[model samples]
Target: MTQTPALQMTDVTLEYPDGRDGTLRALDDVDFTAEVGTITSLVGPSGSGKSSLLAVAATLLTPTSGSVRINGREVTELTEKHRAGLRRDEVGLIFQQPNLLPSLTALEQLVIVDDLRGKPRRRARERGAEILDHVGLAESCSRRPHELSGGQRQRVNIARALMSEPSVLLVDEPTAALDHERSEEVVTLLCRITRERGTATVMVTHDTDFVPLTDAMVTMRDGVLSASAHRGSPDAGSTRRSDRPGSSPG
Candidate 1:
């Protein structure tokens, strides 16, 4: 039996008004998909539209045209309220910064997700604890943001996203603020979590060193997606570090 992709986008295009006379296309007829139990790395330059694709996939920004399906349910036509509900129920977003509330403990951060969903407090706490432990933060449950290191804080962020039990995970520059070692640790943790939870994960990163650790890598340029190559495949070399204009290759 074939499994459907956890997240799919086809012919997606997003345009923003350029001054008053023209439009700037952020995503140009892009087709992207992420399968269950696998992770895909999206690599591109700063202005190459990587974040635009992610925003569209997350339903945070409506595309000018396209079809977006999460767990096989079409979301492009849903109302904002419905789309928000779908996002909350089916998608997990891991931002570059942990942005933890200074006053909230590590576990409390995860519990808040359940609170937003109206889940019972007891069950929320239970699930939050389990997720935190899964991310190797079992002993730091009571620590607040100030008490945790950068890597630990990121782990809490990952755990918090997992609290929703989402089928799809959207990560943006998860290692931007970490040292080389911490970056590798966080990416490895993401890999393990994706496999263990069967989540379809799409991670956007400027770091090419970690791309090979993902199942597949796709390069984006001027809003267009190149063909993806699986890790260790002959064509995988095509996904080499993007050399953006006026910038050194990553």
Candidate 2:
């Protein structure tokens, strides 16, 4: 049987108003996809449309033209309410910063996410525990974000994203705030979770270290997509160590 694409973007374009002249194209005819049980890493220099793509995919920003689909459902044409529902039900978002509520405990964080999606808070509590454990943060459930380390906070963020068991995961610069070791650990954990949960994950980052851990690596330059040879196949544990230049030799 053929697999349904978890995400599909075809001929997508997004632009922002330039002060008094032409628009600035954030994404131009960029097409990409992530299948279930796989992770696709988007790497590029600053201003290369990486964040714009993530924003559009998360329904946080609308593209100027083209299609955005999740689990074979077209989201580009959805109303704001429907788009929000799609985001809540089908898409999971992880940001560079942990972005946790200072007042909410880790468990509360996940519980509230489900609550916001109209799911029963009690039903989500068990899922919250399961995902928190899956992400290696079972013991930190009652801790507030400030009480946890940077890496631990990020793990909570990841756990919160997965609490709904979304089919599509959108992550933006997940390792930007982490140290080298912590970043690697987070990426490895992400890869593991993507496979175990059968989530199609797309991560935007400038970190070259994670290039090897992904099922496929694609780069955006001048709002266009380009494939890279860094990732060989769609297997989760096929990483090989090599001396990547301009990368911290960790």
Candidate 3:
């Protein structure tokens, strides 16, 4: 049996009003999909619509036209409240910055996610501790952001995102603030967690060195997306453009 993709977008186009009558096209008829237990890296220059794509996938921005389905439910036309619920229930967003609260402990950062969902306090703490441990922060749970290293704080950010047990993970430049070694560690952790948790992860990154660590790579230019080489494919390390929009990697 064929399993449904965890995240899918079809003919998605997004536009913003320029001055008065003009409109800037941010995404142009893009189609994309991320299967369960896989990570798809999105690479492109600034202003190439990578952020726009992530926002749309997160249901934070409504597309001008097209269909966006998360776990097989169409969301483009959902009411604002419904969209918010969908985001809370099905999506996990990891921002470029850890953006941790100044006073909250690392474990508190994750516990707050469940708190917002009205989960029981005891259960929330148990789940938060387990997730922190999974991210290799078992001993740092009580430490504040100031006491943790840069990479450790980022791990807290990732663990917080995972607290909801979301099916789709949208990551935006997760390694931008880390050094080479830390970047490698964080990306490796993301790959491992994605596979273990069966989440479909789409990461937007500028670091080409780590692109091969992901399951597939896709590039965007002028709001157009094209397939790139898959990590383990015969043509790996080479760029390949698709004849049409939204071609699957390799």
Candidate 4:
């Protein structure tokens, strides 16, 4: 039997009004897939449509002409309410910034999701502890965002996203605010957690250092996505260092 991809985008295109009597194509006929228990990274320069691809995948943006399938269910044409439920139940988003609540402690941050889901408070607390421990943030469960280090806060962000037990994870430039060491830690954790939980993860990052850690890496340029390649594949040479400033590419 053939397994369906956890997330799939076919011939996806996105356009924005360009002020004049024209449109700017953000994505052009891109076909992307992320399988269960795998992490796919989209690498490109700024304004390369990587985020647009992510938004479309997360069902946050409907494509101009294409299809988006999440867990084998077509979501492109779903009503807003249905899509919102889909997002809450099946999708997990990790923004570039942690965006954690300053008022809530680390564990409370995760428990809030359970509260919103109407789950029991005890189970929420227990589940929060479990995921935080998995992310190595258990010791900091009582700390607030301001009290934790940047990396610790990002860990909380990751843990919170996992609280929903989502099948699809959409990450936006996860390492944008992290240093080399912390970036490596977070990416490694992501890979491990994705495998352990069988989540299909699509992470957008300009940092080429994340290439080797990815199960597959794809390049996006000028609103077009190049076919992806595994690390051992012949096309692996396409994963090169980014010459952009502040980049210590591998």
**Candidate that scores best on TM-score:** 3
- Against the reference, the lDDT scores of all candidates come to 0.88, 0.83, 0.89, 0.85
Task: Please provide, for model 2 over 24-90, each residue's C-alpha lDDT reduced to its tens digit, 9 standing for 90 to 100.
Answer: 9988877677789888888888998888989998888889998888888888888999998888888
Candidate ranking under lDDT, highest first, comes to 3, 1, 4, 2
Per-residue CA lDDT of candidate 3, range 1-250, in tens?
9888888888788999989899999988887888889888999999999999999999999999989999999998899999999999899999999999989999999888888999998999999999999999999999999999999999999999999899999999999999999999999999999999999998999999998888888888988876665756422112223444475643
lDDT of 4 by residue, 1-250 (tens): 8788888787778999999999999988777778888888888889999889888988889999988899899999899999998998999999999999999999999999989988899999999999999999879999999999889999999999998899998888888899999999999999999899999988888888877887888888888776556755433212222322364732
Off by over 4 Å in 3: 231-242, 245-250
Which 10 successive residues of model 4 have the least lDDT summed?
235-244
Residue range 1-250, candidate 1, lDDT tens digits: 8787898887788999999799999988777778888888999999999999899999999999988999899999999999999989999999999999999999999998999899999999999999989999999999999999999999999998998889999999999999999999999999999999999899999999998788888889988777566755423212222332354533
TM-score of 4: 0.91
Model 2: residue 139 alpha-carbon error in angstroms:
1.4
lDDT of 3 at 139: 100
Which is superior by TM-score, 1 or 4? 1
TM-score sort, best first: 3, 1, 4, 2
lDDT of 3 at 165: 93
> Would you give me the overall lDDT of model 4?
0.85
TM-score of each: 0.92, 0.90, 0.93, 0.91
